[model samples]
Target: MVKLRLKRYGRKGQVTYRIVAMNNLSRRDGKAIEELGFYNPRTNESSLNVANIKRRIEQGAQPTNTVRYILAKANVL
Candidate 1:
């Protein structure tokens, strides 16, 4: 199974995330099949690759709850 999820990064208190597609059994920060977007909680900012995301979703990539919410906000799902 493949999943769409967040990969944490940045300094300790200031975290940012990359929206990624990876195998379901992999570590959260492990290798990803593709990086589809970015999100910054502090600034509430997001950048998405909508076309790719939609393609992945249609191919059975399941988003985590948080990622799902983010995608919904972007109107991609």
Candidate 2:
């Protein structure tokens, strides 16, 4: 299954995340089919590719719980 999920990056204690589309069995930081957005908890900032996200979701990519919340906040779902 393909899933839309977060890929952790940035430095320790200052983490950021890239919203990604990848196979469910892939490694957390493995290669992703596409990058759809970014999030930074420290600043509560987010940038998203809404069109792509909707397209992906319609095409059957499932978001992780956290990603789902972000999408909801962005009113994408």
Candidate 3:
């Protein structure tokens, strides 16, 4: 199954994340099928690729709870 989830990155205390389309069984920071957006918690900032995200969602990419929240905040759903 494919899922839309966050891929962790950055330094220890300043981690940022990339929203990606990935396989369900992969690790949190594993390889991604495609990068759809970005999230920076420290600044509450999100950068989204609307067309790609919408296409993936239409193709059955399930977002994690956190990703869902972020998307809602961005009004991308």
Candidate 4:
């Protein structure tokens, strides 16, 4: 199963995330098929590639709960 999920990165206490498409069996920070966007919680900021996201979702990629929240906030889903 492929999924739309967040990949944690950046320094401790100042983490950020990359939105990506990957296999469900992959680890949290494992390889992804493609990057779709970015989210920075500390700054409450996010930038997304809506077209890519829609394409992925249409291809049967389910979004993780947190990713779903991000998409909701971005009005992408």
RMSD of 1: 0.5
lDDT of 3 by residue, 4-75 (tens): 999999999999999999999999999999999999999999999999999999999999999999999989
Is candidate 2 or 4 superior in lDDT? Answer: 4
Q: Write the per-residue lDDT of candidate 4 for residues 11-70, one digit (tens) a residue.
A: 999999999999999999999999999999999999999999999999999999999999
Off by over 4 Å in 3: none
- Backbone clashes (count) for model 1: 0
Cα lDDT of model 1 by residue, 1-77, tens digit = 99999999999999999999999999989999999999999999999999999999999999999999999998988
Candidate that would win on lDDT: 1
After best superposition, candidate 1 residue 22: deviation in angstroms?
A: 0.5
Question: Which window of 10 residues has the lowest lDDT sum in candidate 3?
Answer: 68-77
**Can you write out model 2's per-residue Cα lDDT over 1-77, one digit (the tens) per residue?**
99999999999999999999999999999999999999998998999999999999999999999999999988889
Shift in Å, residue 21, candidate 2: 0.4
- Model 2 superposed RMSD (Cα): 0.5
How many clashes in each candidate? 0, 0, 0, 0
lDDT of 4: 0.97
Listed in order, each prediction's TM-score against the native is 0.98, 0.97, 0.97, 0.97
All candidates: CA RMSD (Å): 0.5, 0.5, 0.5, 0.5
Error of 3 at 75 (Å): 0.8
Off by over 4 Å in 2: none
